[model samples]
Target: MHITSGSALYHYTRSGTSVKKLYEASWVRYCAVNRSGDKIFVTNSMSELLTLSKDGTILSIFTDRQLQSPTAVHVTETGHVLVCWKNTIIQVDIEGNKNVTSLAIPNVDNPLSMCNLGKCIIVGSSNILVLKIE
Candidate 1:
């Protein structure tokens, strides 16, 4: 799976001829696929969390007025979705309840990308920021 600007998610088959797409948002900063490959969590530079089925079907959109600049997203092994804002991480449960985490990558100002690596979150930006989580 790969994402292009202008808010598009593309899934390509082996030979690269077959492509599946989800083109519903204006800007998709990052996306994470669930372990079951049944759901996808997407985010932009703003505060909307979009959920989609693997077939590109729109499932749900979650947003919180308190969130600011939600620049990146990651999905954990336990089916929880984590979104990284400027200085916080918003954790969303399957029921859509939002929990904010005061997690950060030290001195980095831009937590623009992220992924789950076992027990830690590997932050993405111009510099590498790795933070361990309980």
Candidate 2:
């Protein structure tokens, strides 16, 4: 899957053929596909988390106040969705619930991207912060 600057997500075939447009929003910053590959977690400029189905259907939207200016999102191997909100990493469950744990980076002022490396998560900004997750 790929995202267009115009706030649209597309699914393409392995051979590089465009399958279909998956979803569109006012301003989509980052997205992560769930463990089962059936749902997508998206963070938009509105500081909201959107959960969409594979075929472009909106499933849920989380408008938690803590989602302030989310910059990146990642789906962990264990089925948790991690979102980069300011200097904290918020973990959301697969059901789109926002009442989970959040890890605050010690020195990082802002977090822009993140990747799941098995037992750890690497958050990148001006500097990199790695957190070990069990």
Candidate 3:
């Protein structure tokens, strides 16, 4: 599926058609469509963490006020969602609760994108940042 963000998620159809309103938010900065296309990982650049179905039904939302400028997000194999802010990264559980892990990240300059590669999380900023979490 081709994702073009403009306030919502759009899925490209096979016949050159596309589905609109897949997901709606004020600041949907980045989205990761799961390999199955059943679940979605969405980050609002100015708001909350959103987990939703392909049809736009929100499965959950994490309301932590710390979610400011959430530039990117990735879902881990262990089922945790990692959200990246300007200089920090936060983990969210399945229940939409923010995990209390140490928010300390060293020498980050404007984090911009991220991806989960099973065992570790690779983040992209002004430069590339890789964190190995066991």
How many clashing pairs per prediction, in order?
A: 0, 0, 0
Estimate the TM-score of every prediction: 0.79, 0.91, 0.80
Q: Give the TM-score of candidate 3.
A: 0.80
Best prediction by TM-score: 2
Checking candidate 1 for backbone clashes, the offending pairs are: none
Query: Which is better, 1 or 2, measured by lDDT?
Result: 2
Per-residue lDDT, model 1, residue 7, is 70
lDDT ranking of the models: 2, 1, 3
lDDT of 2 by residue, 98-121 (tens): 648887887776687888888999
lDDT of every model, 2 decimals: 0.71, 0.81, 0.70
Ranking by TM-score: 2, 3, 1
Q: Residue 41 lDDT in model 1?
A: 77
Which regions of candidate 1 are displaced past 4 Å?
A: 95-97, 100-105
Q: What would the per-residue lDDT of candidate 3 be over residues 21-82, giving only the tens digit for each residue?
A: 67766766677665566677777745677778878788877767667767777667666667
lDDT, residue 57, candidate 3: 84
For candidate 1, write residues 1-134 as lDDT tens digits. 65655577777776765476764566766788887888887765557777778887778878886467677777887777887777667788753446544454466665777777788878776777787877
RMSD, every candidate, angstroms = 2.5, 1.5, 2.5
- Over 4 Å off, model 3: 2-4, 14-16, 34-36, 95-97, 100-102
